[model samples]
Structure formats: structure tokens, C-alpha cells
Target chain A: MHWKEDSAEEGDLLRNALAGCEKAWADLFRMHYHRVYAFAFRSGLSAEDAEDAAQEVFVKAARYLETFKGDSAFKNWLYGIAHHAVMDLLRKRGRREVLLERLHENDTTSKCSAAAKHTEVGDVLGQLPDDLRMAVVLIYYEGKTHKEASKIMDCAETTVSWRIYIAKKRLRKLLEKRG
Target chain B: MKDDPIEKYLVKLEVPTPQQEAVERALHRSTLAFKNRVEPKITQRENTVFKWFEKYYLAVAFAIVFAAFASFFPWAERVCPAASETSDLLAIYSEVKMLFQNNLVAVLLQGSELKVQLGVPRNVAGARVMFVEFSRGDEKIKVLCLEGSALRVPLQGKVQPVLEAMPTADGGVILMGDSFVWSRAMPQTINGYNISARLL
Candidate 1:
């Protein structure tokens, strides 16, 4: 199933998965794994932690599938689950110090290639406030609109736009600082 | 888009993809967990008296209303006496909860240890009424309006009632009086007030 967000709004795939359809479950996993993994990574979890969180999130979603009630987009509901998983991991790891250190490491990973500038630019991305960083990741990286990002983040669309605007301003300042 | 500096960095930002084997393993385990949690609930619901009541409570309520309309029996003057006779406020509350689940506006409170949901029903005795469910662990207590009547819900243990709900502008009263823990049925009203006042 192509599972477009628009089509998936009726939640047939979710209903099928809840009824123990293994194929439906696998298709949902394939469709969501990359986005969930990306969100986890951008939320400052390590590769290993992100993978674990993704799996944990899917399992929790499956367990609670019946309670979904279809009040929002399935993708938005999935993102809410991912947010809780990331928050749990962050709480376990202790928040600011670990997050800043992991973000700093993103800047140093590639030294002698074209990738280095991109990695350095990511330093500003990493330094943005958590909510702003999430807005940038969902909109700029994941190709979601501000409205979709707002639903996933459980905030108003205006809040999403303001976060994106603030992130852009802060990123500009960081670039100047690096220059 | 390629010239946008922020876009360039985001495009290059490395996100690790889950390997096929790892994803398959997780999916298999999740399927098992889903079956374990959901299947039992389905089966248990099949056998539960509560489920029976939930499935047929509406039918029973309608039948009672019809019987009341056709009777000269003074008992018919009391609507839903069968439900009241049981003196089980919790049971009646559950049936009402199911009847109004879709119309309830869930109020979410922050930083509260207890899971509290408060909402008003769409219709009750030609008036809108509010209810709250307080849940901790496997036990949940629901304080709901009873149209024209009120029943006293008993407190459990040493817990004293602390919070009182004020009447809204819409003629709907919230549960009021000194806060009493509504853990179980009392089978007796502490007063002669309608069920709405007792719930409030």
C-alpha cells in the first residue's frame, strides 16, 4: 500500500493492523521507519538509541491502536508516539549536557570532504532550541508543511511558523559567529 | 532549494536507516505483543456482565420508558426505577458513560498524578450536565449527573471529600459539597436531593 497521508486519514491501515494483519503491520513499519528514525535522531538520540526508540514506539502504538479514535492524521498520531519515546530517552540520559555534547559531535565527524561544510552547518541546527529544531527538521528536512508540523508537535500552526522563523534567525547568527 | 544553506545542511544530515533484519525482528515481536493485549480484551468483553449491560442497557432503558408510558401503576411515575432499585450508582454511571462517550469534551489537567477527565453530556433531562472520571490504577470512579435525581456515592477508606463543583450557567450542576472519595456504591443517599445534586 502506498499509504498517502491523505488516504490514510480514514485509518484503514491502522484498523487492519489492529486486527492482527501481519502484512499491514509490516507495511506500516516500512512506511514510518525512516521518518520516525529521522525524528529520533534530530531529537538528539544516538543511532542505537534512535533505532530502539523507533521499535519501542511502534510496539506501543500497536498495543494502543484501538484507542487511536482517528481524531487526527495517522502520521500526526505516530509522531506523538515518537515524541514521547524521545522524551523518555532524554529523561533517562539527562537532558541538556548530553544533547549539546552529541550535537557538538555532529560537527566533527567528517573533516576532509565536501560533507564537512554541511556538518559544520549542522552545528547551528543542533544549537537551535529543541522546539525550533523540531520545526526545522519536520518542515525543511522531512518536507512537511508548517500545518503538518504543528499537528505532529501538538502546537498551533502559528507556533510552528514562529519557531521556524526563530530557527532561521538563530542559524544566521551562528553562521556569522563561525565566519 | 539547493542554494539554501539550511537546506543543504539538512539534506546532508546523516540519519541511520534501520536494517531489514532488525526491523523484521521488531515487527514480529510487536505482532505478538498486540495479540497478547488486544485478543484477551476481546474475549474478556465477551464474558463480562459489564459488557452485557453495555450492549443492552439502551434497549432496557427504552423498554422501561415504553412501559412507563403505558401503565397506570404508580411505580411507572418513576422513570428508571429498575436502575435505581439496584442502588448501584457505579453501574448506572457506566451505562450513561457509554451512552455519551462521543459527546463528552475531555478536559485535560496538567501535572496531576491522578488521571482525571471532565466533560459535559450533550443532553440530560433536557439540560446539559457535566461529569468527571478519576482513575488510579485498575480502579476508576465516575461522578456523573443523573438527570432529575441524585444518588450519594460513598467514600472509601480514610479519604475525605475536598473539592466541590459549582453550577454552570447552563443549569448543569457539577458534583458539589465537601469532597468525598467516590470509590464504590453507597446504596443509600446521604440526602433527598436529585441524583444531579448528589453527583455534584
Candidate 2:
């Protein structure tokens, strides 16, 4: 209920912000800062970098309010921005290097997944390949209907079904391997 | 895959440490903060993909712009343009086109006429941002609350008499006989089958 209200309010704030309403920008800040922050953190940036990236995301978002599209929900749209900002930050570090790091990064799988639905999971879930990872994130963590996930992923429901099958098997395998 | 029991036990976690409420509140605060600073164009897990670009932003931007310009010149199209153009080569061009092409939504600038805007902007944010107005036609009924491009959110209800939208600068679009310029689209935000009108 709160999230729905919060998003709806954020929608209004975004609308107001575009119209140059004074409180609107403040309201936007109050609403999405930490989600952006957590998003940055979960994407593999250090705390300081996450903070900087979060700030970067908002700054860009505010500057481009004129381009806001109500197409997807406001929140999904914003995630797209934060995703870019985080990517930009990491890209600044270089793609080959980042991938090499991920390929070689020490395991942190022991960390329990966040109880909070939207935290690092956004990063982790998105971290996976479109097939195995996306399904795991949506079904296992996000608790979305496979049907809904299929819509977002633009895959056939059966593909989602198969992906989820492989994803869970892989996840359990990963967890056991990690343990 | 359907009968897989592990799917049942996968585990459903809440948003965070406190409650979904606390995390939501924190996220909301973060959104406000983030928006106060910079409002970027697109945010998606693909953003991480962009991080790969940042390392070579200038190079990438240069490559993209150069490529766009090259592609736009219809140079390759003029050449061999036939069936054997080059498989991998054309594929790259298609991928590049997708970047700037469909992101736009349509706007009817004048009566019985329309324009395709390249980007989404404040002028049309939260308005219908789709080719077919993603929602049903339920939002066009009794509430006519906009003047030119300005919105009266508080007074938004059912649109009566089916008010017409004016041409405005927004995300940016390509109109007939018009060169590239940033312009806004009308508020047809939720282009659903049933959205004849909207609440806000």
C-alpha cells in the first residue's frame, strides 16, 4: 500500500517537477534516493562510488524531466536512468576490466539475499543472463508471475517457464556449490 | 518446468531489513534526492551495460554519431544496396537504428496530422507515451483539463467532449518538412483499450 502510494505520489512529484513546482524536486529526492543508492551498490560499486553514482543518477533525472515518459511506470523509467548511471560509472572503469572482475571476483554468495524486495536484488537479478538470471530474479526473488515476467522479458510464457526451470536448478546448484 | 517443485520453494523475500515500508520510504527519499540532482534518460539493468561504454564514451559517442551520419547519408544504401549488402554489416546498422528509432511516441501536431518525436520530455511525461496510447480509451471521456501544454492535475478527472491536444516541444520528434528539433507530445499517456480518460 505504501509503495503504491509512494509511487503514485512520486508520479505526481515527477509531474510537478516537470512543471517547475518548487516542492516537486524536493519530493522526488525524498522518494527515490535510496532506491538509486541501493541500486548502485548492488551493481558492484563501492559505497563511495555508489553514493556518487546515486547523486549522478538523480542529477541527470532532474535535468531531463522534460523527457520523462509515462510509458512504463515512473519507477521503471527511473530505474532505467539509474541503470545507465551505474553502467556509466562502471564503464568509466572499462568493460573488459569490469567483466574480468566479475569473472574473477571473489564469491560473496554467502550474503543472504535482502529481505527488502528492491534492494541489491535489482542489481543481482539483473546481473544474470537474460535467460537464467532474469528468471531467477523475477520468480525466486521478485515473486512476479511467470506470465508477467514473460511480458517484461518479451519472451514466450513457455520460454519463461523453461528459463525458470533452468534458473532454479542453477541457483540451487550455485548455492550448494558456494556452501 | 511447470511441475518443478523447487519453483514453489524458491523463497519470497520482502524488500529489506525493516519492512517493505521502511525500504519503500527510503527508496522514495532516494528518488527525490536523485531527481533533485540529475534526471537521466534511460535506466535499466542495461545501464550496467552502459558502464562498459563510459570507459570509451568519447569513442562510443563518436562511433555512434559517425555511424549515424554515415548510415543517414544513404551511402551504403546507394552502394550494392541489393541483396548482398553484407550480413554482419547490416545487422550492426539495424542495432544502431533501434537505439534512436522506436524510443519515440507519436503526436498529432495539427488536426488529422501527426509527428514522431524521438525522445520523451517533461511536456509529455506521464502522458500517453505509446504508439497506440498504451491504455484503453477510457481516459478521453469527460475530463478536459489541459490548456496548450500546461496541466491542471488537481482538476483532472474524466475528459469531457474529448479535448484536443496542441503541438508542443518535448522528447523531440521528426515531423514532415521539419528538421530535427525537440518537441513534446500530447497527454495520451496510458494508451489502453479502456482508457477513454484518466484520473490525474
Cα interface RMSD of each candidate: 4.0, 7.1
How would you encode candidate 2's per-residue C-alpha lDDT over B1-200 as one tens digit per residue? 44554443343322222234544544455445545644454577767778778778888889888888887785657666433523433343345436555443223222233333343323444453211122333332222222222221211334312223333354332111122121233233321222222212
lDDT by residue (A1-179, candidate 1, tens digit) is: 33334464335766687677777777777777778877887676665677788888888877777766566667778888887787788668754665565555555653224445434544566677677877888888777888888888889999999998888888877877877
Highest DockQ among the candidates is held by which one? 1
Give the range of the ten consecutive residues with the poorest summed lDDT in model 2 chain A. Answer: A103-112
| Lowest summed lDDT window (length 10), candidate 1 chain A | A110-119
Tens-digit lDDT string for candidate 1 (B1-200): 67977566567766545566667776777776666544335545466787888899999999999887869787767777645633564454455457556443322222333122334433444433335444444444555443422323343444444334434455544444464322223222223222223332
Misplaced by over 4 Å in model 1 are A1-12, A95-122, B1-3, B19-22, B38-200
Lowest-lDDT window of 10 residues in candidate 1 chain B? B187-196
Retained native contacts per candidate, as fractions?
0.37, 0.17
